[model samples]
Each structure stands twice: as structure tokens, then as C-alpha cells.
Target: MIRLPDSSGRLRAYTPVGKGGHGAGAQGPAPRSRTVFAAAHVVADPLADTTPEGPAAVDWDATLAFRRHLWAHGLGVAEAMDTAQRGMGLDWEGAAELIRRSAAEARAVGGRIACGAGTDHLPATGQPAAGHTLAAITAAYGEQLHTVEETGAQAILMASRALAATARGPEDYEQVYGALLAQAERPVILHWLGPMFDPALAGYWGSQDLDTATDTFLRVVAAHPGRVDGVKVSLLDAGREVALRRRLPEGVRCYTGDDFHYPELIEGDAQGHSDALLGVFDPLAPLAAQAVRQLDAGGAGGFRATLDPTVPLARHLFQEPTRYYKTGVVLLAWLAGHQEHFTMVGGLQSARSLPHLARAYELADGIGLFPDPELAQARMKQLLAVHGVH
Candidate 1:
């Protein structure tokens, strides 16, 4: 429960509902001995648009602080990846600079870091000029890949909206990936993002049909066994991801990006489990890191106990009109005191509804996502006041 003075300075109590009062064994996340990766997003400055190059604003201090928080929890940071609003509002130039900045920060702190390499600069909506071809796309990937490598960061080969727009079939996916993999300095994680996150990737990996796309995607991984380190599956389809994980090359990893169903996906079945690479983790770092440590103790039941409760809040934050999910994410950051204000790049904080955000606050408070739930509730009420919803 929370007690705070209202606009009129009258104190009132607000009770926060939790998951029936259970912890440490009610089906939370299990600890993983394997290295866990989180494709973290950059927290934006609330007061101004910092992206002089484009619409996105990058809150340098808060963003780096969040990364430090993840590192403190022992999770590897995958910077400049999709979770950082890449292609949404964060432009390619901004992404490259972010990778460079974060790489330096990671090095300064002895943290693990990886950066995304994609063809977002190739234009997601406009027609390619007359002579454009996959070669151009390949070159684009090469440029970004080299930049990441030069920064001394591992590479996450993200899916291309441009490729999805122009591919003829699975063959296209194979050809593009094969070329990129052949030249990589080290084994890289290939990313397969579903359209749910960004509709522009509707038929990513060549075919619109998921099964065919998976087949084509895995074939690339299979063909380049040594060069591809692992695959980041963001299809939000746990079953398919599991099936695909079973088929990966011996040394490769299956990094899950399914925020909708991560606890179960990472928990794995008899076959195997996925390593983490989620945007949700950016906000749930401490809790996720703690749960994974429990799993490492042969206590999955306990791990899930810690994570399951947060699912409702995660689901709510990532609610449909899905891409706009960033809004709720930033809101929680502000309320949790990770950032000083509630603003977002491209003004994305205004994306969700009052009731929607209201429920997010309620659910978050319920799960104890905040260290000081009272402060969170007070901030939430202030947010409600801005929209005249209180």
C-alpha cells in the first residue's frame, strides 16, 4: 500500500495488490549457467529531443546507468539492438554512435557487449534506386558489422526490413546470410524478428509462412556451423523456437526475444532452453538476473516463482499496437526512478491509454517491480493527473 499527499496536499492511502503473497517457489525464472544476453534500449531524455540527426532522443546518462545496472546483475549487454528503438525512432547514424558510446562504456566497466548490424538505412518504405540489389544490402550489412567489430563489440545480425520487402523466397535469406557470415571476423548471432514487433518484417527470412521462414533461417545457421554463434528468435512463438533450438549447430545458442512468453521459453523443456535477449529485461534486469541465478541452483520452480508474477505487467507494457510498447517501458523507468522524467524520443510516452498505463502501474506495484512501491504509485498518480484521468 502507498500513502501520498494529493494535489491539494491531502494524504491518502493506496493499497497495492501483489500475486496473492507468494515468493521464491511459485514458478519464477530459473538460474542459467549460460551467459545471458539482454538487448537493452536507451533511456531517452524527458525534457528535450536529443537527436539532432533525427527524431529519436538518447538520454546518455540514464541509458548508460541502465546498462551498468544490467552488468551489475551479471547480464551481458547487447547494445544498439532492436530494444533500443532501432528503426522506430533511433536512426542508423544514431545507432552506430550508440554502439560506439556503449562499447566504450562496456569496456570501461569490463562488461560484455554486442551490437546489431542491419540494413535499416537502406530505406524501409521507399523504392530502391534502379540498380539496387542484394549486393547493396550485403554491403550495408558489412559496413555495420565492421563498425561493431571495430568498436570491439560482438555482432548481432538483425533482420532487415528492406530485405523482407524485396526477397523472392527463402533462397534470398540464405544468400544474404551466407554472404555476411562468410566474411564475419567471428561467429555472430543472427536475429529473426517477427512482424508483430514491426510489421515491415512480415515475410522476413524469405517466406511469410513461419514454418518455411524457419526452415530457411535454420538452413543458413546449419550451413555456416562455425561462423554463426547462435540465433536470436523473436517470433514470439515458443514452440517453433524450441524446435529450431534443437536444430542449431553444436556451439550455437538460441537467444529468446519472446517477452510475451519468456519465463517458459527460457525455462526450456527436456530438449533445451533459450538464453535471454529481451527488451523486457532492460526494465526487469535485477529481477531477471536474480531469477536466473535461482535456476542455476537447480531450482526452476523457485525461478518461475520470481518471474511469473511480472508477466502480467510485462504483457501489459507490451500490449498491442505492439510497436508503441516503448511508451509504457519509459513510463515504468520514470516511475521506478531509473530516469528523472517521463519523456521519450519521438514523444512515444503518449502512446498508451490512461487506463492502460494505470493498469501497468497497478500490476507493477502488485509484483513489487519497484524498490519503493509508494514512490511509484505517487508518480503514477501524477501521470494520471496530467491527462486529467484522476
Candidate 2:
């Protein structure tokens, strides 16, 4: 039994439903119709001095083991992505190493893997001439793209903070992407991360009006049909994402990064559905695998029945200040025993409040995510006590 805090500031006693309580139905083969990848997180070296402005020091063993865990459950790994804290705390040097190591690990186990390639290496404050900025951003991307291809992994052209800061209009985006896409060793996934995730990207696609932006985005894809594989939309607006999905040129997939409404998007409508490259999938792996298995077995009803119950938990973890949702992710990972401590790169564990985390814990427990409820309860109590909770 565990006592947890609710919204009204009272502790509620809860019992363990335990893992396997959901039954997960029998795990079938991976989903055939959809390509699912879980944008993974890194385990911080708890002993490192991970200050707000300092460099990140990660636990290589734990980090790689988590990827193996995802692959073991039949999900591809989306490495060094936002879920891995790319712009937040992880530097380009760290991300490059992670890509090489994770890509190598995936090869050893026959796991599908894609790594984020972006222009995060550029200093955020440096203001250069427009041409200089575009050239530098392109060079930065080229460097990371080279690293990813050299490591034998697919590349995801992540939305660039530098480009977002520098670009004057859609033509600049097209010029930069067109050049990079032409040089790709294979078709790569493009990313359109919304301003909600990174405010620096407020006017993506050269317009605040998403429809206009979508048009410009499509124009880029139109110019390079064979060079693009798909686009990962993390806008959190389902209607817009669906709209974009319907418009993508044939053969280009829309990988849903909408954490709040993934089941419906992936299950999709009659015309087509989005594939997935989601951050929520990191914490929801076992359940997601089971749900995808159900879909693979042609039991859409079973798939919905399995996944719908977990939405409240997902919604809570992904609540406002959505970027900080990474805190809840690492917290759940700790309570569920994925890592020994809740510490994060750059001390991001402190990003969320105690109450926010308490709610996340309660919600996860409600869904039977913790393999051992007793252990989860104990960890929760330990965390609360640290914050002076009686």
C-alpha cells in the first residue's frame, strides 16, 4: 500500500495492481502497417556536476541499456532527440557520441534506429549575416549528418533552433533543406517541432499561420520527393497534424509526435494513419508494444481497449510547460526502476514541482505501469520525504 498526494493536498492510500495486471494480452509480432519509434531519454551520471549551464555527463551503460529495452519490446530507437534533451542540456559533442554508440548498439542487436541531426552546435547568441548564418547552419547539419551516416543509422533532420533564429522567409528554408536533402545518403525524416516545444521556433515555415506554413513545408517536400522519407510533426494540434498527414506526398509518412493523442492518430482513419516517433512512447514502452501487437494481429478494438486507459497518464505527463515533461519522464523511469536515481542532465530533475510529480506517479500507478507497486510506492514516499512531505 502507498499514500499519495492528490490535487486537494490530501494523501490517499493506494494498493498495488502490479505489472502484468493489465495482462498486456499475448505479445504478438511488431506492427506491420506502422513504423513506430520511441524517442529515447538519457540517464544522467548522478555523481556528475550537472549545473544549469554546464556540460552534460551521461551514464553510457544505463543509457544504452534503455535502448536495448525498447528494442527488446520491438520498438525502433529515435536517438539523441528532444526526448534525449538535445537543445535543453545535451551539447552537440555529447549527442554525436550518443549517436555513434547507440547506432552501434542497434546494429549489434538488429534494432532499427534513427538519430537526430541538427544545427544546435551554433552559439545561440551569435548574430551573423543572413548568408553566413545559413551557411553555418548548413555546415553544422552536414557535420552531424556525416556522423549519423558514418555510424550506419538513419538521420532525422531535426528542426533547427539556429535556422529558426536566422531565416528571413520560406525561401531560405527551402534553399538550406534542398541543399542538405540532395546530399543525403538515404531518405531522411524531416521534423517540424512547434513553438510550444521551443519558442525560438514560433514562425516556422515562414508564417505564424500554420496553413501558410504547411504550404511552404509541402513546397520543400515537393521539390525533393525521393530524398524525403517522412515528417515528424510535434505541434500537439491533432487536427493540423491530420491535415498535414493527408497532404504529404505519396510515400512520405507523417510520424506523429503528438503525445496527447497518439492512439487515434496511429490507429488512423480509413484513408491512412500516422506512424510514430513519440517521447511518451519512452515511458509507455511495454504497454505501447502490447497495443501495437494487438493492432498487428488485426484487432483494432483490442488495441484501443489496451491503450485508451493510459491516456490520462499521458496527458498529465505532457501537461502545459510541455518541454519540461522530460522531468516527469525521468521521474517515472526512476520509480519504475529504469534508472537508480531521478537525477537528469543539467539538474533538470528539479524542473517540475513535487505536486506535479506526485500527480504523475498517481496517474502512472492508476494505469498499472509500475512493475512492482510496492517498490514504486516506496520510491514515491522517499521522493516526497525529501521535499518535506509528511
Candidate 3:
């Protein structure tokens, strides 16, 4: 039995369900029903002399190995996304390296891969000089876009904090995105990451009102047809996403980023279902792949049965202050033995409190996410003891 601390500072005894729950070794052909991509996380080099404000020190071997694990489970790897700490600890240079390396690895393993491209090279804050200008933002995005395209991977146009900070109104957004869309070498996935994921993006698409903002968003897409493969909606509003999915132009897919309601969203009604590009999938890849395979076999009920139980863990990992969700993600990765240390780019491992992490461990353990529950339990104990929980 392991003792886990609750929010109330009380310890609760829990026994791990151990191995043979939901095996992580399950692998198969990619799901034909939905195009799913797990936004993967980067492993930090724990021994590096790194600081919270410094450029990320990535563990290239372990990081690439984790991507291979995701690919082995028949999941597309969404590399260098927010889940990889872009705009947080990872700078533009690091992200470029990651995109190139992971894309090459994906080709070697015959795995599907898409990479995020944004103006993260520019300082997020609006500068008095070139950084604040729409042209500068566009140029920054172009540079990153070129990098991803050269790697022969699909480019995901990630929501930009720089654009959010600099755009004067919807027209500015339209102009900037319009320019980028026109120059694309291939159809790209547009990401609408809600402010909940990053507070700097509160008034994205030129309006604080979601209705108005979504209007601007659609106009941009409507202006550039066929250039967009899909829009990855991370608004966390299932109803809004459904509405948006219905409104998208023919051939434009809606990849759901809603961690909370994915089971139902993916298992849609008569209208249609959203494809997935979710951060939660990083840790849930094995079971998620199995569930999608079930969907492919026309067993929606089985898909729900397999995936519904995982919602609690997803909700917990992506709780309020949602951007810090990466912490719990890397934690689970460590517990599952994907990495030797529970460290993250930018030292984000300490973002969540001890109680919060404890709960995440309990929830994930309950779902049998770990390949070896004993290793997980031992890790959890070591973490707790470090915090003086014993």
C-alpha cells in the first residue's frame, strides 16, 4: 500500500492495481476512422546546468525514444507542439532542432508526423521596434513554417502569442493569416488554442467574445480554402467545437483538442465526429490507440467503454491553469518509465503542487497507465518522500 496526500493534507492508503490491467504493448495499424495525433512532450536532460529562464536542454535520445513509443502504438506524433513546451522553456532554435530530428525519426519508423510552426522566435511581448509589427510576426512565422516544411512534415500553424499581442483588430489577423496561408507549400492544420491554455492569448482572433472571435477565425479559413487541412480546436467547449465543426468548409477537418469531452466528440452523433490532436494523448497513447481501433471496427460502444474510464485522469491533468498541464504529462511519462527522471523543459516539473501531482498519480495508476505498476509506485513514494510526505 502507498500513502498519498490529499488536498486537505491527509494521507490516504492506496494499492496499485499492478500489471495486466490495460497493457501498453498493444499495437496495430493506424485507425482509418479518425486521424489522431498525440501532441508529444520533450524529455529534459536532468544533469544539464539549466534554469527556468534558460533555453531548454532536451534529452534527445529519450525524447526521440518516447516518440517511437507513441508511433509503435499506431498514433501520429504531433511534434514540437505546446506539449513540447514551445514558448515556455523551449525557444525557437530548440523547437527547430526537435522538428528536424523527430521528423527524420518518424520517416525512419514509417509514422505520421506533423509539426507546429509559430512566431515563437520573436519575443512574446510586443516590442517597440520590429517585434510588435504585423510584418515582423508574419516573417517570424514564415521562418518557422519553412523549417517544418523542409523536413517533409505537415505544418500545424499554432496560435501565436505575438500576433495576439500585436494585432489591432480582426482585419490585422485576417491579413497576417491570409499572407501565411497563401505562401504555404502544402495544406496546414490551423490551431485555435484557447486562452485557458495560455493567458497571453485571451483575446485571440481580435475579440474577447468567443462568438465574434470565432467569426473572425472562420472568415480567415473561408478566405483560404484547400490550404487548410484542418483546424485543431482547443477551446475546451464541446458545444462550440461541434458548432464550429459543422460550419467548417467541406474538406476542412476539425481536430478536437478538448481533453474533457473527447470520448463523445470522437464518438459523434449523425452529424460528424472531430478528429483528435490532443496533449492528453501523450500519456494515453496505448489505450487511446486501442479505443480508436475499436471505433474503426464499428464498435463505438467498445470505444466508449475503453476510453470513458480515462476521462477522470485527463480532466485532472488538464485542470485550471491548464498550460501547466505539461507537468502532470511528464510526471506520468516518468512513472510509466518512458524517462529516467521526472524533469521537464524550463524546470516545469515543479509547476503543480505535491497534492496535485499525488492525485494525478493516483488517477493514472487507477487506470493502469504504467507498464509496471511497481516502478510507478516506487517513483511516487520517492517523490512523496522528497516532499517529506512520509
Cα lDDT over the full model 1: 0.79
**Model 2 segments beyond 4 Å from truth?**
8-10, 19-29, 126-132
RMSD of 2: 1.9
Quote model 2's TM-score: 0.95
Stretch of 10 with least lDDT, candidate 1: 20-29
lDDT of 1 by residue, 1-390 (tens): 544334454545757754321211232232346567777767776667454345676778888988777777778898887678888778898898899999999999888998999987775557523324788888998999999999889999998877776777788778888999998999898998888899878888877678888888888988987898888988777788888899887878999988889999888889788888888887777778878888898889988998898898888877777787777777777777777888766666667766677667777777767766666777877876776545
Q: Considering summed lDDT, which 10 consecutive residues are worst modelled in model 2?
A: 20-29
lDDT of each: 0.79, 0.87, 0.92
lDDT of 1 at 110: 82
Greater lDDT among 2 and 3 belongs to: 3
> Could you tell me the lDDT of residue 293 within candidate 1?
85
TM, every model: 0.90, 0.95, 0.98
Model 3: residues with Cα > 4 Å off, grouped in runs: 19-23, 124-131
Error of 1 at 367 (Å): 0.8
Candidate order by decreasing lDDT: 3, 2, 1
Q: Judge candidate 1 at residue 310 and give its lDDT.
A: 81
Q: What is the lDDT of candidate 3?
A: 0.92
